[model samples]
Target chain A: MTTGVRRRMGVEERRQQLIGVALELFSRRSPDEVSIDEIASAAGISRPLVYHYFPGKLSLYEAALKRASDDLAARFVEPREGPLGARLLRVMGRFFDFVDEHGPGFSALMRGGPAVGSSTTNALIDAVRQAAYVQILSHLDVQDPPARLELVIRSWISLAESTALIWLDGRRIPRAELEKQLVHDFAALAAVSAAYDEEMGALLRRILKDEPADGPFADLVGRIVALAS
Target chain B: MTTGVRRRMGVEERRQQLIGVALELFSRRSPDEVSIDEIASAAGISRPLVYHYFPGKLSLYEAALKRASDDLAARFVEPREGPLGARLLRVMGRFFDFVDEHGPGFSALMRGGPAVGSSTTNALIDAVRQAAYVQILSHLDVQDPPARLELVIRSWISLAESTALIWLDGRRIPRAELEKQLVHDFAALAAVSAAYDEEMGALLRRILKDEPADGPFADLVGRIVALAS
Candidate 1:
């Protein structure tokens, strides 16, 4: 870890290092509070090197956010074959685990003010949510008016996101208990949605593919499908 | 308003004045950034007089929060005799309206940081949420397990809260569109849960309550009940 060792690295490796350090500092302090000079000093690099990596603080923030988004999406889209409910439960479990491990960074991402008018994060979140909806609709074997699926998908996403917020606030519910409750709760919602006509279900499945699934979402897709069907 | 009338007042009037000024300031800036002296200066009162009304900044913050919470709860819990869906929608609409009008204050209450700890604000928000759950549950016409009722109530609250957060971000979905989507979504979830077991159907009805014989939610609830049954 000596600063004296100046080793050259591949572009991808250097890019990842910058994101990792930026996320670390951003999690500990506000975006405005952390300066480019501090990042450069901490990384043992010259100011020009930092500038070459990111033109400005805003660009650096976006790049960090993109890494986080990509990481989350990758986890969510992992292949799983099983009943929608089972698969969804597994996915959600993974999501919660990730959040617990990376609580500070996740908090920074969520609680940071207004994404500076960048719709990138919101779009990414929405894409993941859509994936869960598609997984649920497909599992449930629903095919009907698109609106019904939209309703069901939105309902599930709301439940999952709210639950995660509560959990993050240090509620004392055990991990097992939380998982059981989520499954039960989601299953109940899915069952209700399944009664709607099939057209909405089909439309929802389409939206699912349009969005990349990742981050704090677990097997939400399958559970949603099970409930819708 | 006159800046320095210096009219002597009783304890109650003085206390009211302090709270009014504090809330005005807190709404405009973070609670941590605002100070007692600034509040006193704004209200045109002596520092000692402000202290006489409240012991310290934290206490004053709690008092202002309590006042806002009480007002919010009152608005959300008003009686509405209609179908379960319509009544629930009315409650949600009022909630969104309150958030829109009091964006800064409401955001402070909801997004308060770790520095704020768990203030009375949280308890107050929880109470209002519970009240909404009770109102929604009252319309249901079912005798089911307590756990099932809890599931429905939790899911509904989650949906309502999440929607409010998104709406607070200034995403401009029309009220009609939001309501329609919510009703359809909740209905689908209710139908799916009911199909899981007769008990779940009873739970869904109990949570949504029975719609008036000819009200808007009557057909929606009936259709859901039919699907689940």
Candidate 2:
């Protein structure tokens, strides 16, 4: 867009555009490395104009993080469809797509501890996690999960999070394999828990009954039985 | 243990005593909430004397963290005898023991991100994780792990770390159950990787062969198979 169009932008529109610019810059590098002048230039706006929207860099960073957190939470959304495994695999795809696209930004947000003692950043991280947990539970169609099931879901969420963070360190493993493996990991975690608890067992059986012979959950069983043979 | 005997302690002894005292206080409460006067009084020494050992609170906090990190690493040590599952369970027991005893301190160390912009604290955290990784690899008896195996190990490590941190929040679940579940998590994670890769499959076979039917690993397999039937 021309500078004329940029100047005529509405107040909220300009604020959002500035946040988008800051996020784009922050994604390429650590937020600490990006400055207000750089963000203003990237947005085709002046330094003073950037200040008009955000009081300072920390405010801008948090705003950017809030947006990123929302985006990350949205990635966990998947339509209820055929098999739980297939749906989960799609969810992981979108989740990792966010990770893959926002490598440095994601790392900085997850790793930097977000402004050192800033509860806001921690809350944002927790919000994303809580969102993912809720989304998965909704997919499971459970109103209130048993304790063991909760542990499995929370543990798997942690696994998926750390797996993505570590994967970004070098991208050593193929993106697709990690994605599928994560879905399998979820089933594996739940299966192990189900084996020990009656409620979890009932839950697993219910989930498995809905899974098809060629679905991801059944495929995990197939591989295990193959190993036994 | 008398104050008279404490006064007779040597320079190194006094320094060690100070660190120990600081750790004890830090363990019960966040480091920021604890002060030099508190540490000094806890150690039965003058505040200046406490400064004689540590340059400042930050230095003292780092020192206490160093000791905690070393102790944490030591918990991963296991005799090369029993089945891997039993050994892992024991390790998790000790790991959780540390988490249980140092509730606020562990939270501070793991969740607080240490000093703002302090690489020292981050490095200490990484060192603990690395130490755990090496110890587990030695237990697996693998000199050079395949990519998938590495992923499993690293992912499991992250899982255990996050599980413990989450558990410390309210600790609604029994500590003993979580300890056992973490070991099972390792097996579940590794088993899933084995299902997907030949090298990991062979590694699983090797591990299973050594595991008694009553071992945790075998118990996991039994659980999965039981779910299928």
List model 2 lDDT by residue over A1-229, tens digit each. Answer: 5977877899999889889988889888878789899998998778998888899988888898899989989878888877888999998999899998788888877665447457677778888989989998998899987767777898899899889998998888898999999999999888877877888899889999999898888988889877755
User: Which 10-residue window in model 2 chain B sums to the lowest lDDT?
Assistant: B109-118
Tens digits of per-residue lDDT for model 1, B131-154: 666655555533343544455466
Model 1, backbone clash pairs (residues 3+ apart or across chains), number? 41
Every candidate's lDDT: 0.60, 0.85
Runs off by more than 4 Å, candidate 1: A1-77, A80-89, A93-158, A161-229, B1-6, B28-38, B141-145, B183-185, B203-229
Screening candidate 2 with a backbone cut-off below 3 angstroms (N, C-alpha, C), the clashing residue pairs are none
- TM-scores of the candidates are 0.55, 0.93
Interface RMSD of 2: 2.2
DockQ of candidates 1 onward, in order?
Answer: 0.12, 0.59
Candidate 2 structure quality by residue, lDDT tens digits, B97-169: 9999899988876665446336777778889989999998999899897778778888898888878887888
